[model samples]
Target: MTVALMWEARAVTGRGEELLAWARAQELTPGPMRRETFRAPQDRVLVITWWDADYDAVLPELPDPGGELVSRAAHRWRFEPVPDPT
Candidate 1:
């Protein structure tokens, strides 16, 4: 089923840029078909996600056992097609 991944993470100040760079650099493998980021009033979240070629098709590429100061919060939402708004 077509779906989207929503992930949020927090790190020390300056870590945001570092994380973003790392994420972009991961294109050496099963890279993200696309990704984006946003900032909130009181939180910094890294929104790493991509198109679903079968959500499970990319599970193995995920980090196993997390990383130092790199925590993750992920949720999946299925797509709901809508008629053209034209």
Candidate 2:
């Protein structure tokens, strides 16, 4: 099975670029199959990482960027692809 982990954060005012750079600089040990980063209004940053593992498997994830860089703690979620109904 494949699992996708979502990590989202909102940077402090006027520090969106810094937060993006920080998030991009983080390296995951043994890296995920695929990783993507994005930004949105309100200085929100979102990162999604795909891994080939069970839904409950332990996988590497990005750590907190500290309180100074963000408005609040990051938000994370996990998802799996829907199976074909055939």
- On TM-score, the candidate that comes out on top is 2
**Candidate 1 displacement at residue 53 in angstroms:** 3.8
Off-target runs (Cα >4 Å) in candidate 2 are: 84-86
Give per-residue lDDT, candidate 2, residue 64.
92
lDDT values for all models: 0.48, 0.96
Once fitted onto the true fold, the runs of candidate 1 whose alpha carbons sit more than 4 angstroms away are 39-43, 54-67, 71-86
Candidate 2 per-residue lDDT, tens place, 1-86, comes to 89999999999998999999999999998899999999998999999999999999999899999899999999999999998899
lDDT of 1 at 51: 64
65 Cα displacement, candidate 2 (Å): 0.7
Error in Å for residue 61 of model 2: 0.7
TM-score of 1: 0.46
TM-score of each: 0.46, 0.95
